[model samples]
Target: MVGQAQAVAAPRHHEQSHLRGLVEVAGASVLWGTGGLALQLIREHEPMSPITISAWRMATAAVVLLLALLALRRGPELVHLARTRPRQLLVVGVGTAAYQGFYFVSVTQVGVAVSTVVSLGLAPVLLTVVESVRQRRAPTPGRLAVLATALLGLVLVSVAGHASSTGPDPVLGVVLAVASGTTYALTALAGGSISRETSPLVLTSGMTLVGAAVLLPLLAVVDGPRVSADPVALAWLAYLGVLTMALAYVLLYSGLRVVAPSTAVTASLVEPVTAAVVAAVVLSESLGPAAVAGIVLVLLAVAGLGRPSAAAGPVLPDPGR
Candidate 1:
């Protein structure tokens, strides 16, 4: 009876844990959705360049996360990570800065909705392909269908958003967005490998610290350092750093620790949807019928990925842990 009760409780616990991870990733995506708007708004008040914003975002997040670790008495753990896993930290850190820097530059060339959709929408597709290659098998039909639906949705959103965009250079923006997505996929794959064995807080703190170290130097090469004195711009910068970079990434690493990288990226499909709606409402960026349909399709793809299916193969425990 005792063994049977334990068996029954175990699956239930796993289900609940997975549900929590999904929620955490979803929350992170929502927070990230607001980032483009924040960056745009920040620039409206200050002439700080994209690299400047990216650098400050990383620096601020690093400071906040490191402080949190100290408060939690986990500062030594962060040091241990730095001492033991410097390579992983550097890969994820540099990758994080590169993707974000690419994304913010894309936002400048393209409108927020288009940039967000193209950059974020491309990641899951890349990750899916990588996973299929890693497994040495073709993606199951169900997974293929879901990927196709997502790709179709991403196309609709991109085309519709671009058609109505007033940005200076849509083509250039798209190229940068693609670069961002590629870097994002690589970072997720690297980070996912270690997240399960490391505390999310410690990992995030280390990554942000390393990211800041990488970006701060680039600030000088790009445009020299520019500080914004405007209170409003400062507030937006704070929000971008704290809510989007620090907190959102903590949630993301937490989810990555539990879910497959492909599933985690698919869940983040929510980011573009959230960005589109916010841009339409706040920035007066209009979304046409096709874009709305795309949003619905993306949501459906996310849902489909979350549901367990036979074609997805047997649930294998993460070897990383």
Candidate 2:
């Protein structure tokens, strides 16, 4: 009876832990969903180029995270990560910068909603394929079906007439968005793998520092390098750096420690929905019928993932346990 009771408790505990990881990943996505909108708000006051904005975002996040690590007397961990996993950290840092750079540039060409959808929506597909290849198995039919549903929704959001019209160059924007998604997928895999042995806070600090170092020099490439002086715009940039970059990523890496990279990215599909809704309410942007339907499908797909299915076999075991 004691052994049976222990066995019963173990699976229950595992399920609860998995659920917490999902919530953390989803929460991070919600914060990230606000990013494009915040960037848009900053542009309204300063008209900074996307590259300049990207540099600032990374630099700001790096500073804040480093300071926090020092405050906690965890500064040595950053050095340890740099010395031990230099290659992996560089990949994550450069990958993070590249993805955000592509995404911000895409926003200039495509507007907020479509750029957000195309970039974020594409990550799960790429990551899922990567996972399947790594695991040496095909995704179960149920997993494939869920992926298909999510992709269809993404397609709708991307091509809807009203959604496309907001961008000056939708085609170029989409190309950049794809670039963003691909880089994002690679970064997620690297970070997720590394998080298994590292603290999320330390990992995030090291990555952001590398990201900032890589992006800072690119500011010169911006046409004018317009830095915002407005208090409100500065505040918005702080929000982007602190909330979206630092906090969101901490949550993300934490989730990745327990959740499979593919599933973690899938759960983050909530980002586009959050972005679309924020755009509609704050920017008065219209989502149209198809776009609305697409949001619903994406939400349903996320819900489907939360439940047990054949795909459950692919889920990474809870690493912390």
Candidate 3:
């Protein structure tokens, strides 16, 4: 009787832990979703180039994260990660820097709602394909179906959000946005794989440090040492650096302990949704009927991906055949 009781309690505890983790990941998504909206807000008052904004954001985040690591006495662990996982750390750092740079540039050129929806909406599908290739197995039917649904939804969203105003060439913005997505997917996978063996804070701090180092020259050339001319712009930059990039990553890493990587990615779909809604509400941007439909489809696709697949057995890789 005691054995059965302990077994039942174990699962209940795990379920609760999982719920807590999901909440953390959802919170991270909410912060991430605010990125574009925040940028739009800053751009309204002070006109800054996207590259400049990205560089400052990364550099600031790196400083804040490094400070936190020092405060927590994790500096040694970061050095150890550098020695053992240098290649992986560099890959993640470069990917992180590139994703932020390209994503900001794409949104500035193509508008926040459209660029964000497209880039984030496509990340999971791409990640799934990458995971399958890495595992040396064919994707199962369930994954295929989810990918199809996600693609269809993406098409609907793209068509709905089409603009006639001829902003920066849509083709260029789209190509960069897709590249950003690829970098984001790679970073997530690499982070997850590395975090399995190391402390999340250490990994995050090191990556941010490396990314910041890479962006310093670009920031100097593009912005010429002007971090921000206006107080509001400075505030937004600080928020992005401290809350969204630094703290949010720490929360995300913590949440991953209880959530599967696939589920965490699916949950992050909330970010784009929040960004679009904020744009519509605060900026008074019109999404049009097709955009409404696309949003619905994207949300549904997210839901479907969140559901457990029978073939995969709750997080198991599907059989190759």
TM-score list, all predictions: 0.88, 0.90, 0.80
Worst 10 residues of 1 by lDDT: 310-319
How does model 2 score by TM-score? 0.90
lDDT of 3 by residue, 29-101 (tens): 8898788777767777677766767667777888988888889888899999999999999998888898878
Residue range 69-129, candidate 2, lDDT tens digits:
9999999998999999999999999999999889878877887667766777778888877
Alpha-carbon runs more than 4 Å astray in model 1: 1-12, 106-118, 164-175, 310-321
Q: Is candidate 1 or candidate 2 better by lDDT?
A: 2
lDDT of 2 at 19: 69
Alpha-carbon runs more than 4 Å astray in model 3: 1-22, 107-118, 134-171, 223-225, 257-262, 304-306, 310-321
Give the Cα lDDT of each candidate.
Answer: 0.81, 0.82, 0.70
Please give the TM-score that candidate 1 achieves against the real structure. Answer: 0.88
Question: Candidate 3: how many backbone clashes?
Answer: 0
Q: After superposition, how far is residue 259 of candidate 3 from its true place, in Å?
A: 4.2
- Model 3: which ten-residue window has the lowest total lDDT? 312-321
Evaluation by TM-score, superior candidate among 1 and 2: 2
Give the C-alpha miss distance for residue 301 in model 1, angstroms: 1.5
